[model samples]
Target chain A: MKTSDFRFDPSQVRTGYSHSTIFKEDGFGMNYCSSCGVRVLTQVPEGDHLPRQVCPSCHTIHYSNPKILVGAIPVWERKILLCRRAIAPREGYWTMPSGFMENGETLQMGAARETFEESLARVTIEDLMSVINIAAHNQVHILFRAQMDSPEHGVTLESSEVRFFEEAEIPWADLAFRTVTQALTHFVEDRQRGQRTLHLVDLETTRP
Target chain B: MKTSDFRFDPSQVRTGYSHSTIFKEDGFGMNYCSSCGVRVLTQVPEGDHLPRQVCPSCHTIHYSNPKILVGAIPVWERKILLCRRAIAPREGYWTMPSGFMENGETLQMGAARETFEESLARVTIEDLMSVINIAAHNQVHILFRAQMDSPEHGVTLESSEVRFFEEAEIPWADLAFRTVTQALTHFVEDRQRGQRTLHLVDLETTRP
Candidate 1:
């Protein structure tokens, strides 16, 4: 399935739709108040250092924070599963099954759910692999090492192609995002060292 | 420095202001659209599984996800620093310094910021201690172990009292949040075992 299938209105196309632009627009582009429908003013609320979209009528200060993206690297028979994106922000590039985390779910649950959604593969979420902080884009990517329940996997709406790759066959240059590369690299290195370690990375740039 | 000091209007009081209720209201209590000033309707958008607050006029779907609370367990000379909250939901209860993670900051930066905000102590954030998913409240609490830069510390507006506490002297009964309790327990246990291991906990209930 294409990413446009997820959007309700196709005509309102967002040009240059990178992840940073999408998050910035969704997070800070509040024109009216959600509580009272009044046009909100961009000002610093009392005792607040940062300016927020504050409603003058209802005295409500709307806050926007960084979002978390949960994902997992699924391993089956010593091969890692990857999904080729059917979406934008680097379409057709391979990445571990991941997406924005939903509410009312644990990190493990989100990872497993994203894996199933993208690759059509059921996985048991394992230990935390990497916690990448993309502070510039206001996103935190959390990835886990997962064990595939079975070898059964197929393409889904979010992924046009799904397949397993050995360590030597990983398409290093065609990875979708920097966080994906970081997680996959760490996974490979730790496996070679005969250890499982959690990596915390702070990515300062948007370069992939 | 009561919690009311943070609010602009004290008369608009939230009765029985627990963490779950606060998050529930903040995460799902949308009435009007933020994009357009029209009243939003609760409906499932096309190809969406869950109901969302969707704007009829502008076709903007407001997605609410779980929030991240970044905190630090500050240690100075074999003693842990704790803060007595001056706010509601657990006023006067002891807790490690913590608050909502902000935009444009890494997890370590947020942990240190909250540590200084509540306890007035500058700290160098260390390894991740615990990641507790409070899914029932639509929140995830990430705690880190930190080393104090100096012995200097004081109380802040968020905390009525702040001081160092030995493991035996920690007031277990007066601790504020369950996530805090879990993190502290893990910290003490890991220190005793002479190993630093990250703890991942999924708290199903709101019981403190």
Candidate 2:
């Protein structure tokens, strides 16, 4: 479909629009909304050149824009909290304790909640790690650089496993999402810029 | 309906499965996809909270999340690019020269395109400004602190009119999006931070 057909009123930015078909043939598959678990509808309407997805309830439209996905950059000593997913798309892949933004929750709260839920490692979020947008998923994932309250806490959520991987040990290939890779990249870049100032908190008093 | 019926995937970070009744009863109106203008569907088979939007044609399901919008902090000499919208939601209110990212465009490209499209002034995007998640529209709007290519170039887009208003001349009450106000706040804050190194570039030529 023509790109212009998909464009809508700027005011519609608040509420998304319905989509027409845009994918080429053989694109049929379970279109998963990473943030919203809706099944993508791919039917192209008449007078449309492309297939698009639209929110059934909210009537908001979807675009391949970057979404703000928040995560924890919790560090204990020289290690950080990482979770192995117990779910699909990339089951068993490692990721920072992170998730998407929720209604009524600030970015800070989202990061904190995800960190605690995934790692059981309570942390007081520090400054931002970096804002990286994964446009393919329409997410602007925010990795908040936090410090853990304790270093010895075990896993809590549906994580297959949890571990404290040192900077050199980060598994770049097995990262759950590109955001983690981006976050780690930023972490290293920032460190090179001399920004890795650990407050040197003891692991004993760090657990919730 | 259960809150799960209006489920949002924290994993993906976008809204899906909102109650269809919410829109029908509240008259919030519907948003359509920009690629193919169609009303996004709402009903699902049953008990599914996957947060998906559907297309009528091509029958391809496409998943979408929140979008990240970037803006330019147009500064000319001691003035900036500000406008009064001639449209709705905030009719006649003031806002920055900003728009959404088109497909296949970079964040910086979108910013530059939007700034000139809305204000008619070309600029060289510079440093990053503070990023904010505009939850009201399910967008993460990033406002970059930018520099005008020519101080004398005027605005050319949907603005009621354009002007390089000085800080003291800013019409605070008439300001539009919270991001605009916030950007202005940061501008003042940066000045107070005592970092007054405004990069100067000679305007080789001018544009109408």
Error of 2 at A123 (Å): 2.5
Task: Give the 10-residue window scoring lowest on summed lDDT in candidate 2 chain B.
Answer: B199-208
Candidate 2 lDDT, tens digit per residue, B51-109?
33455654334344455567777888868778778767687888887776643334555
- Per-prediction TM-score: 0.87, 0.63
RMSD of each: 11.1, 12.7
Stretches of candidate 1 exceeding 4 Å from the true structure: A1-26, A206-208, B1-26, B206-208
Kindly give the stretch of ten consecutive residues in candidate 1 chain B with the minimal lDDT sum. Answer: B1-10
Q: Which candidate is the best by TM-score?
A: 1
Q: Candidate 2: lDDT of B77? A: 81
lDDT, candidate 2, A1-208, per-residue tens? 0011111123332122223211321222325332344445544334322344544544434434334457777789868678889877688899888876543344665677677667777777666556553333333456667778778556554588989888888899899865577677777667778874211110111111
What value of lDDT does candidate 1 attain over all alpha carbons?
0.81
TM-score of candidate 1 to 2 decimals: 0.87
- Residue ranges of candidate 2 with Cα displaced over 4 Å: A1-65, A135-137, A156-158, A172-178, A196-208, B1-67, B134-139, B152-157, B196-208
lDDT scores in order? 0.81, 0.56
